[model samples]
Target: MKERTIFQKFIHTLVDILVLLSLAWFIVYSFFSLYRVSGHSMEPALSTGDTVLIDELSYRFIKPKRMDIVLFQRADKSYNMKRIVGLPGETVIIQNGRIYINGELLETTKISPIALPGLAKNPVELGKDEYFLIGDNTDSSEDSRFQNIGNVHFAQIRGRVWFRLLPLRKMKLIV
Candidate 1:
């Protein structure tokens, strides 16, 4: 009888552990995802081969803000990361290698003057759901300035990149 009681307690503990693990997995699967940075576009912030953790749930509760680093799906269905420069209902233009929004200079330390302004050479208007994105590496990034990538719609954005998880030495919050 003593042996049977011990075995039963062991089984109960095992079941509790399994349940806890399943709950943890479900939370992670529903609220987060991982992405790898593949190009120099977002350099100095996110580098090639850097792994990032994406928070998929926050956007549902809050609107994306300017300067947020986001993971979005391109029209080709490939994923890319970029920083938000212009928000909805804004006019964005690139002149003299600098960015202008609503006829005013958009200043941020993250971006430098870009050599190739792409479609933004002319004033580009953003729709209610559209956002202008650029990479930290202005010269190399293929972003909203170009015709191919264009403005990113809210639906195309997968999640906000909040943390860097890989390359243990470099691990830190991406904010």
Candidate 2:
């Protein structure tokens, strides 16, 4: 009798753990997710292999703004992280290796210098609900500056990166 009781208790504990784990997975799947940075395109801000938390709900209430780092849905359905440099109906240009929005030089602040200029080297007018994205590490990033990925629509944005979760030393909310 005691042997049967012990076996039942062990089974119950195992079932409890499984139930908790499944619940946790369901919550994360529906409300949030984690993405690992794949390359150096976001260098100095986000490094390769950095794990970030993506908030899938924020854009539903708020529109993406300039300098917001987002996970963009590419034409091939893959996702890439980049910063918003130009908004809907704004004109973006890369001249003399500096980014200009609407004829004014974009504030570089903490961003790396754009060396190649790429496609945005010529002024591109974004359409309504269109956006221009670029990487913080401009020189090496293949972003809206390229012809193939130019003028991303609002529908292409998957979510905004809200926080860094790994590399414990740098774990914090992304601004």
Candidate 3:
């Protein structure tokens, strides 16, 4: 009788462990995904090969705002990470290595200096569904400033980067 009781307890504990594991799997697969940074575009804030937790569900309830780092599907069928500098229906310009929005100068403290000018040299007006994106490392990123990439459409946005998971020394919530 005692052996049977021990066996039952073991089965009960096994079932509980399985249930907890299943719940964790469902939440991670449904609401979030792991993303790895591929380039230096987001340097200083994020680095190449940094694995991040992408919150894919939040965008469903909220539109992306300025300064938000987003992962987007590029025209070439690749994913690129960049910071949102101009929102929909806004004018963005880059001149003399600086960014201007709606004729107002925006102080850029994150990105590297732009040594070369791109489409932003002229006033680029964003449509209602367009968002201007640029890399924190403007010197190396090919973002909305290029004709091929242009402005990121609302549909192309995949998710917002929320945290870093690898490189324990650098791990933290990405603000």
Q: Residues 4-29, candidate 1, lDDT per residue (tens digit)?
A: 99999999999999999999889877
Candidate 2's displacement at residue 27, Å, is 5.7
Candidate 2 local lDDT, 9-68, one digit each (tens): 999999999999999889778877899999888888899989998988889999999999
What lDDT does the true structure give each of the candidates?
Answer: 0.93, 0.89, 0.90
On lDDT, the leading prediction is 1
Which residue pairs in model 1 clash with each other? none
Question: Which pairs, if any, clash in model 2?
Answer: none
For model 2, what is the error of residue 146's alpha carbon versus the real structure, in angstroms, after optimal superposition? 0.4
> Across residues 38-61, which tens digit of lDDT does each residue of candidate 3 receive?
888899899988999899999999
> Residue 160 deviation, candidate 1, in Å?
0.6
List the candidates ranked by lDDT, beginning with the highest. Answer: 1, 3, 2
Worst window of 10 by summed lDDT in candidate 3: 108-117
My TM-score estimates for the predictions, one after another, are 0.85, 0.83, 0.86
Candidate 1 backbone clash number: 0
Query: Over all chains combined, what TM-score does candidate 2 have?
Result: 0.83
Backbone clash count for every predicted candidate, in the order shown? 0, 0, 0
Clashing residue pairs, backbone N/CA/C < 3 A, model 3: none
Q: What lDDT is reached at residue 75 by model 2? A: 91
Model 1 residue 74 CA deviation in Å? 0.8
